[model samples]
Target: MADITAAMVKDLREKSGAGMMDCKKALNETAGDMDAAMDWLRTKGLAAAAKKSSRTAAEGLVGVAVSGTKGAAVEVNSETDFVAKNDQFQQFVRDVTQVALDGAGDVDAIKAATLPNGKTAEDTLTTNVATIGENQSIRRVKRLEVSQGAVVAYVHNQQSAGLGKIGVLVALESAASNDALQALGKQLAMHIAAAFPMALNEEDLDADLIERERAIAAEKAGESGKPADIVAKMVDGAIAKYRKEHALVSQLFVMDGKTKISDVVAKAGKDAGAEIKLVDYVRFQLGEGIEKEASDFAAEVAAASGVPQQPAPVN
Candidate 1:
């Protein structure tokens, strides 16, 4: 076995168009022989897979899997929706999501977890990218579980049975019957998909987000020409409202639009003759935060045709 240096691996990745891990493995497999490494990558088809790795992949599916008291959600992105519909790509999302439900709680863990095909998730992903002829990536994974009750999974705008545009999991802890838990969990999951709560509770909201809201509120209050005490009160009120509107428990239930989620859970528990708690939740909207690049199609066509620029008439 040879000691594979970073520079050597970088060289192999450049020449072979393979991922960093694959390049390093190739170098190690061939005792640092660059040509042998290239052959190794080519044999596995890893070299061709990553040639398009630089392309932006913002379209794909969010897959969900649930078992007993646990559930998992995963987002696998592809450069185009056409590729997303590929059978292989959908299977990858399904397999990786099951891995997440089995305890791979994070992106790295899911990638490292082995698939039924005897390939690690990363290897499977690379192989898919090669066969699919598009850049693809496992964007994220989120798992939720409860101690005593149920973890329910839901998908909206589904492309397949459990893969879709929006994936949600709702964890409910209770001694209630499975039927009751399922019903409550489904409604809550549906609410989560539509409402898009930021956190399970107000205190769970991101500190930076809260601070940014506070700053915005303070600036608005400052423009009010009110007394310092009144301005401070206004800022506080704004922050409080923001937190309530964004936190899951404090948010008004989307079902009827009047009941807070906390109250909804309480009523459901009362009807079930037990104490039911909303334990945790995850909502993954595919490509939610990705900034997609916009291309000028007409400009690209003109450039391809080698045509001169034309000015538009004044409106």
Candidate 2:
């Protein structure tokens, strides 16, 4: 067998438009023969599939899967909402999310994992794109595992089991019964999904963001006609308030609208006969911060109906 080089992989990818893993596999199977590699990819329908890789896929589903004390979530995106309902795409998201469960929150590891059909994650994405007639992607994935506690998962806006528009995982570290811990974990995960808090505590919050807020607060304090001591106190107060509002455990639980999540966890811990800690969490909301062009429906309607009489005014 001929030794396949990196250049061969690159060339195969360029010609077939297939993913790196798929290209390499094809090249290796063809004994580093470029023409044979191209033919192999084409026969598998992977070449045409790769051509759709460049399309913007900002809409799709978030999927979650849990196994024992670990849980994982993944975001699989498509170019349009119509494809999100495709059974195959949904199944891919769900299966990939399960694969992510074994990855220990490593996105790269999850992407490199083999799919059930003996294809890499990237190859699955390419195949999905070709069959669905739209570009698709495994946008992100995260796994949460606990040594002595349970990792609970939640999927919001679910179209099917373990697949949805929002996915969340909450890790609760405790020596309590899994049943009790999981109940609390589910509620906490829901709280996190709804609130989108920055961190679990003030110390964990983004330092740069905190510093920026403090600067703004100090500037405001300087105009208050107070002494330096008073200004310092004012800045401290502002920062404390910011921390309470932004931190996960400090923030009020959205479901209840009054109690802090930390307080709830403390109470649950007592009932469970162990000290419970919110060690970590992961939340994946589909297309978060992905800007899509907004259209004015009324304007489009008028233009289509030939009723657009308004002319641009000279500035």
Whose TM-score is greatest here? 1
Per-residue CA lDDT of model 2 for 1-315, tens digit only, reads 889876678767865788999999998899887766765675565775222222233789999988878988888888789988998888888778878776736667766889898998778888888878998887777778889788888887788988887788899889988998889988998888778777888799889878766766776678787999999999999889989988998999888799999999999999989989989998788887564554557778888999984754757
Give the alpha carbon lDDT tens digit for every residue of 66-127 in model 1: 98898999999998889878999999999999999899988999899999999999999999
* Model 1 accuracy (lDDT, Cα): 0.86
Best by lDDT: 1
List residue ranges in candidate 1 displaced over 4 A.
1-57, 300-314
Count clashes in each candidate, considering only residues at least 3 apart in sequence or on different chains: 0, 1
* C-alpha lDDT score of every prediction, in listed order: 0.86, 0.80
Weakest lDDT window of 10 consecutive positions for candidate 1: 48-57
